[model samples]
Target chain A: MRSVALQKGLAIAVPALVFGFLVAAQWATLAAPGSRDVGIRYIDPLTASLGRLQDEQTSLKAQLADVRAKLDQLQRAGAAQNGTVRDLSAQLDDLKRRAGLTDASGEGVVVTLDATRAAADLTQDRLPCFAPDLTDIVNAAWRGGARAVAIDGERIVASSSVYCVGGTIVVNGSIVSAPFTVTAVGPTSSILAVVDDPSQLSDLKRRRDQQVVDLRIASVPAVTLPAYGGPVVVRSATPQ
Target chain B: MRSRVGGAAVAAVALLLGVLVVSQFRSRDVYSRSLEQETPESLTTLIADLNDRNRQLREEIFDLQLRVDRAQSQVSGGQGTLEESQRQLEQLEVFSAQSRVTGPGISIRVDGPFDDHALSDLVNELRNAGAEAIAVNDARVGPRSWFAAGANGDLVVDGTGVRGPWTVRSIGASDVLYVAMTRTGGIVGQFQLIYQRTRFTVTRENALDLPPLAAQ
Candidate 1:
């Protein structure tokens, strides 16, 4: 009787053990931090590299500032030494303004372009603004008699390049995400007229009407645009 | 017979515990590997270092190019080309935001609740209006400048947190920027139509001084 009972119990215990083990295993799998229960996803190496590059650019910018300060001091000292140097220094200042290297504040307008919350949540293609759209705005600003134009503080010069990559706009090698603010320093009336012109910034206006982009334009008493921070290397160009 | 039953129950419970432990260990190992590999703190520092290195390299390359041009101009015995090179160098210095600039412009103060998207749009509008230089709360805006919401939900520009009310200084015609900003059915107008609690104000300044991108 004892042997029969032991055998029956063992038979029950074996399946019970396996069932319990299976349940436990499934629970364990679900509970892990990287499992379905956790929403955080892994970042790929390409993103990692982009992050690293941005960091490097910032530190280098600080160094560039230091070097520039020293150069300014030297230039000032040279200006003190001779009349010719002083005149040349003045000329240099004018050139700086033209080169998009000097930060200047003057009468202008600030236009803000942003994706509606809904649009931003959608696919990149559905987003209202792209790199070319900004380029068109810059052109319109120029037509409006803008002396200088900058996008999100990046001074746009003759050599400045604009492109879109992965839903971000890159201007002069800097990534500009929306809401994109385009500041143009020029004649207020002309800028306003241009901004109001149905033909001017028509693409943006169309997108706004289509509910793809949210755009804002305002005239302030004063505005300041930062100079370009990208390298200006003219390797092959010669004087005309 | 009772002992046999109790022993079986105990054996089953032990088996369950053992399986749980092994499964948990394996799952954790596998999922954790799939999770984000780097910590935020580490990524921040790494990015900063890399940006610095890249800037330095580009600067070095620029300096070398300038030297080559200078030498070539001298070898060619063209004083005009030399002058042209010198002029270009000076222009590059300013264009690169190496020099400080100041002038009459407009200041747009966005007292949040606002997002990075809003600020970007404002900047774009400013550029369209012909802003020469711009700064967001004193951090000079540049080609490398980027804005994003930080982990703490604050707007960060180029890795620096910008506190509100965010002041966007653009050197340009203050009146034009003001009108462009406050025009009816424009950005500010549209913003008011949606979120009524937020304040967007544009002030025209007679003189605004924007420092260089970096002084360090």
Candidate 2:
């Protein structure tokens, strides 16, 4: 009987051992280096396309810088030669400054909106509404007397629109993700008065209270806003 | 003793099989989660967005190059500075809402109950679609314009009270503005979903005039 039991055990143990070995081997192969490429193979083409687009953007930006530099040089030269040109140049500069085409710096406020730990859990559903909240903050800043404003380093110009497109916040045609930083150049007191008031930004205030987002406002002695970099030509509108 | 030994062997194999299965499943779970974060569709959208931005940058570069050429010629020619500067100033003034503007654009008339937020969204959509100038009722939207709910649920633009049927006129490419406002899931559609009673009529106009912002 003992011999028979041992024989049965051998039958079970031998196959089980072989099956276990096979599984172990397969697991090791999957865990091995370069095995992850099986999944990445599907993403490779998309990754390559993204890389190409990024490189194109870099080249385009360089060209823009070059052209803007040349325009500046010509403007300076024209201003130096004639009195009327100089006067017009000054007027143009003022208009450009007011139009947010020129960089601005002064005592102002910085408002930052960041997703909290709780926000991470609710991001997909709740975070898309961040655009309107950001709009309210910016509008409050403007009402409180901000001369120039920028969100996440993208200057807010006359044509800048803060809105959501597929769960992303777009400012001036550029996609930005949180934590959103808004820098405004103007009277700190005035900006704070409007921004700090819960009435002006009720939705953001409620979201902050619920710990959905963290809102911070700080007054700085000097804050500089970058000039608008997007297309500025009036292609369709004619001045009357 | 032989049976015990066999049982021990079986138990050890079972443990090994269980571990292998768990590890395999864990790895697969991680891989799938990572793929979810960057699906092919999302990546394609990102690529298309980047392409659009690069196109805009190229256009900006070309425009700037033309300006530089014109400025260089004017500086050398000595007669075009005043005209060029005046032209640039007028453009800037139009952008800043400091001068009146007239152009082919689109007009939206809201003939029902709507809040300032809806108006703000409409204006934002117009700006996103390249509206060079915007005016709601009689109030011109400037660089620092803000829409707020005034007393009694009235719509206020930069502290100016405006009543409905509100007419929003924007200066831009008429076709582009119209498409932006009326497209599926656009502002008009969104408003239709939220404000059921409101009627939004978007008309492409050959000529629309927008006045400068009233002095603060």
Candidate 3:
């Protein structure tokens, strides 16, 4: 009778303990930060919203291009008929070029930044390429007297901003991922001088040394940068 | 007989636990697979970018409509074509940092030891807040303007050395710019966080003038 009772206790206790363990494990997994629950709850809606916005942007860009083409045609026709208009057109073209409204190509330096293998490892806490990192590279090129600058094909303009939305970097309202390529058109030697200097780009250099980021800088004879295709609105300031 | 019945009951309980564990594991696998490509941070960023893009698109639509009107006027030989062109040129001149601009805006006076990175971040924050024109000390901030550390730890804006007690003037809507500068988690707050000794005095002015870029 005693042996039978002991076996009965063992049978019940073993399964009960196993069931409790399983329940606790499942609960812990669900309750932890960055768990499946959080990911599914937030990511799905955000991604869907992003897709809709991108679609809207594409449509708007198409409309803007159409209007711009029309304006160009009208200006060209006017320039052909009137000398004053022709001169004004030339001046406008120069200003537009200066304002980054037109494509530019010249000798300059190209800096490419990529996350290293270490950064790819999930255990690493720091990302080698952030908004500030890209901003620093762009600024360094400008300090070296770049005529025009583009990052990942988005032209830098007065109103353009480089910022991080999350882990991704954004420039002029466009999403850009690494490996980020910063192309600057100017005096090649001067641009390279600043971009390659460790003192000037200390943060990037530190990361490069740590194998966090792979940074490559080279001078090219000619690099073409696309025009500023983003909005050009001055809603606040009036000429004073 | 009692032992046999107990064994069957234990076997049933084990099978039920196995099924529950398997189901939970399967659900977890599906959830992780769905989220493998994106982290929560990345997803949040995507949402913010989308919102910003939509706002920009709205602004672009407004600008394009104006351009269309201008083009139609020019095509019809309207007398305002030259005036329109001149107006557009002036706007571009201000935007390209080729001319002086004055408007209601905000000025921030910062007194502390800060690096070029901080200053650049400040300028970027102003731009993000829709500053039409910006100037640090006397140097105009342009599209190509860059801030760097000068010799002796001085801040250099496009090669112009500027020390502490830096005054940053921006041209934009006074109220909007003011709120942006003073808001929680704004540039001023961020600066204070990083530079503990920094003092930032932000004032909204009815009229502030910003000079053009110095001749290069």
Best by DockQ: 2
Residue-level error in angstroms, candidate 2, position B100: 0.8
TM-score of chain B of 3: 0.74
User: Candidate 3 DockQ score?
Assistant: 0.26
User: Per-residue lDDT of A138-178 in model 3, one digit per residue for the tens?
Assistant: 89989898999999988999988888754566788876767
Off by over 4 Å in 1: A1-44, A121-129, B1-57, B60-216
TM-scores, all models, native as reference: 0.48, 0.79, 0.79
Native contacts recovered, each model? 0.10, 0.50, 0.44
- For candidate 3 chain B, the 10 contiguous residues with the lowest summed lDDT are B27-36
TM accuracy, model 2: 0.79
| Higher-scoring candidate on DockQ, 1 or 2 | 2
Residue B31 C-alpha lDDT in model 2: 16
- Docking verdict class for candidate 1: incorrect
**Per-model C-alpha lDDT, please?**
0.63, 0.77, 0.76
First chain TM-score, candidate 1: 0.77
Q: Considering only N, C-alpha and C atoms within 3 Å, which residue pairs clash in candidate 3?
A: none
lDDT (10s digit) by residue, model 2, range B2-46: 667768878587657756665554433211112123445655676
Model 3, C-alpha of A84: deviation from truth (Å):
3.5
